[model samples]
Target: MNITEKILARASGRQRVSPDDVVFANVDKVMVHDVSGPGVIKVFDKLKKQGINVDKLWDPTKVWVAEDHFVPSADKVSAENIVKLSNFTKNYGIEKHFKYGMGQYGICHTLSHEEALVLPGEVYVGGDSHTNTTGALGSFACGLGHTDVAYVLLNGKIWFKVPQTLYFKLNGKLPDHVMAKDFILKIIGDITTEGGAYKAMQFGGSGINEMSVESRLTLCNMTTEAGAKNGIVEPDQKVVDYLSSRGATNISLIKGDDDAEYEKIYEYEGSEMEPLIAKPFSPENISIVREAPSVELNKSYIGSCTGAKYEDLVAAAKILKGRTVKIRTEILPASISIYKRAMEDGLLKIFLDAGVTVGPPTCGACCGAHMGVLAKDEICISTTNRNFPGRMGHVDSQTYLSSPLVAAASAVTGKITDPRDLK
Candidate 1:
């Protein structure tokens, strides 16, 4: 069995499981953000009104809630949604609620991993599609709809159809200017958007082993764009050390069996990869940074769970250290903790000195809810995930997706430029 299969099998109390096997597995944790929490609460209420008694969640400690999307209340509707989430969390006695502007708050995915709320070999679920981000820690995590979330909240279990696994074996050392974002973009370019539909993408080999936890998270986080059910990396010493630093103990590392069946296998040489850019409108429309059409930018943004990590910011700051951005630039740290660390390390100062506007830790602009919405005819070079039409603002606005390195370099030139050129 693959890692995903092993985790699901253990959770479902089965000795062995195969692809397409349906199982009602026990969940270790369930995460919900303000954007999706209200809908889940509504579903829970509707079920209760139908005479299904659910006075409390199956396990209050196991359910995590965070106010991220539309955070700081972008509008009246979003504010009302936060209110609903707050009321529900308080009334339900959920002790793990991270409210807006209170405590350690940030994007749910980043905060969850940083706080070690989810761990290896666990079966986890979140209301948002990027829940698969937690799979970087060796867990089997996936996204479900509000209805499925409500069911998990009430019963601590949810049904799942075992998915076929796709093996992505990454080898060779990465070039100095290449990053996990570039590698993932290369993979997406090869496989296309729907390539991994309903399958678990299991990453292995020396390249993944050499990557930091932040890189691994970014790698898994974007698999959702490829239509993957989940993206996972086998646990190693690096994972264990990260979890331990965050106070996680008793970690159980799970790996694929030697003869595990794979739906497909892809092998990539990290050293051969170059910085990649996903053109406007589709993540699969990728091109090498130097070869991509040279387009001017109105704004450059570096934020979101995918690109707002400490290492990502540091990389950007290194490029922007002695320069000023020709275009408007926004820098958002993934969480308050990350923000504080950046500040201490002078990364934030570097960004500010480069004429970059540093924003609070929120999913504000990434999802187009607030902070930095684009106007009509505007073009943005951003480090956020997704470049779908109207993703960051007006339907006519264009968003080109790239890594923080490329984003910072482009900001300095006000165009799609390569970071290596600056070097």
Candidate 2:
């Protein structure tokens, strides 16, 4: 078994096991953001009113709550919701509570690692589908629906069907224009939207060693899009270096035995992949923008939990150092910490000089509510997940998902174009 399998096996109280075995596993941590926790709280209340012991749900110390989607209160309704969420946190006494405007809050997944709440080799669950982001630290993490989260919170354990393991071995060296995001888009293109359902994916290859930890995180963060239960890469020195920089050192390091069994294996040479994007309505609907026809964009965004890392910011700044963003484009950092680091490194000044709107480190545009929303017939090139029609606030609006460099180049060009083709 690999690290993920080993961790899951231990948590399931089994010495060794194969896939497809249903197991009752204790959840190590549970996370909820303001956007989803409110609904989960409502369900918990209903369960309590029906004479169910809500306290019997998960332990309070194991829950992490953050105000991310509507931080600083975007509007009256949102403000009221924050108050309600605050009340819930107080009532539960959850130690991992991150309040709004604290400058310590960002998207839940990013902030969880920042606050040192995620520990490697543990099974964690969150109310958001992107909860799989935690797996970057070598943990078995997945997203659950409100009802599922509520049940876990009540019982501290949930029944899970063991997932098959798929090994993706990457070969060759990646091109400068191609990145982990591009590689993932390529994988999704091959597998389609629901390709890896109920399967845990293990990524390792010659090319993986060349990718930075932040870049690897970007790749693993989107494993959920592949319909994967979880995604993992072997914890190498890069992993140790990254955690050490973040003041984290204690992590369970496990690797698959050389003779460990795997259900499926695929090999790929990522050297030739160009910058790719997933069109609206389907993550599998992918195309290399350079070869695709031009599409006018109403806005372009260059930040998200996936795209707001230091290297991501550096890439965008390098591309936009002396250029100006189109009037409709915007960019935001992942969190205040990231913003501070960028400013200290002079990257934020470059972005400001380029005329890009640098909002707070909150999830500004990703939520489609408080930030750069779209109008009718508009199309946005964004780095966020899910580009369904109306995702950015207009039902008729369309969103194109791409990397920060692609989004930055598109914002400057006022159209969807590849960064390599620019200037």
Candidate 3:
């Protein structure tokens, strides 16, 4: 079995496992956001009426909460939802709730790594589809629906049908102008949105080893766009170093067997990779940055768990530094911690000097509601994972998803522009 299988087998207390094997794996960590928290509460309400024990979580210490989407109390409904989540966490004694307007809150997926909330060889589950993002830490992380999450909260375990692993090998290091986002976009294009459904997508090879931990997280984060069950990379020294910096010390790495099996193996030459973008309406509708459609872009959004990491902000700052954006641009860090780091490193100043709005670390803007959203007929080049119609605002508005460099470059030109093409 591959790394994914190995982790699942261990978490399930099995000596060995394979694709399609059903097992109830004990969960090490679980998360819920404001939206899902409320949904889970509703599930609990139903469960309570059904005479199931819904009065307490299996382990409050193992449960965490994040207030990302619908944050800043987007509307009256959102405000009420946050209140419900706060009460739920308090009642359950879950101390890891990262609330908005509080000291260290941001997107849930971003928090998974920044706060060292999840570790390698664990079975972590969250209520958001991007829960797979934490697999970068070598955990068997995946997302679950509201009822499924409520079940995990009460039972401390959930059943999963083992997913076949798809191994993506990067043969060489990515060029300075390229990013993990480009590579993932290229993969989504090749596999299409439905290709990885119910499958584990594991990244490896020389290029992945050469990439930074945050870059590897970006690669795994977008695996959801390919409809994958999870995305993971083998834990390494970099993973340990990263978690240590975040104050996590009890780090144990996990790796697959020498002859680990995979459902299929795909290889790519990272040196030959270039910046790529996914056009509106589908993550699989991709094109190289230089080959993107010529159109007036109304906005350049560089924020989201997928693209608003510290390194991503630095990459955007490098492009926006002395170059004023030709169109409106927004830079929202993925978390307050990253926001502070960006400010401390002078990245925020560069963005402001470049005439971009540096906003709070909120997913509202990236998810396309209650923040700066696109107007009808407007087109945006964003550093986000998905680009479905109305993903950002008006149902008629269009979005093109790209790496931070490409988005910042296109912001300067008011058109789809590659970072390498910038003067």
What are the per-residue Cα lDDT tens digits for candidate 1 across 1-423? Answer: 988999999999999999999998999999999978988988987998999987888988898898888887888999899889888888988888887678688899998788899999999999999998889999998999999999999999988899999889999778878888998888888998999899998888999999998999999999999999999999988999999998988987788899888898999988788999999899999989899897778999999999998899998998999899999999999888899899999998899999999998888778888989999999999888899999999989999999999999999999888898974
TM-score of 1: 0.98
Task: Sort the predicted structures by lDDT, highest score first.
Answer: 3, 1, 2
Output the worst ten-in-a-row residue range by lDDT, candidate 1.
Answer: 95-104
lDDT of 2 by residue, 1-423 (tens): 766668778888999867888888889999888878898988988998999878644589899887778777889888888988888888878777877566567778787666657777778999987887777777788899998889888888887887888887889777887777888888888887688888887788888878887777777778888899987777777767677677776765767788877788989887777899988866788999887558877788876777787788887887899999875767777777778889999998898898888887667667577677788888888887667668777788888888888888888998887888889
Query: What TM-score would you give candidate 3 relative to the actual structure?
Result: 0.99
lDDT of 1: 0.90
Each candidate: how many clashes? 0, 5, 0
The CA lDDT at 321 in model 1 is: 98
- Which candidate leads in TM-score? 3
Clash pairs of candidate 1? none
**Tens digit of lDDT per residue, candidate 3, span 348-408?**
9999999999888889667886579988999999999888879899999999999999999
lDDT of 3: 0.93
Candidate 3: the clashing residue pairs are none
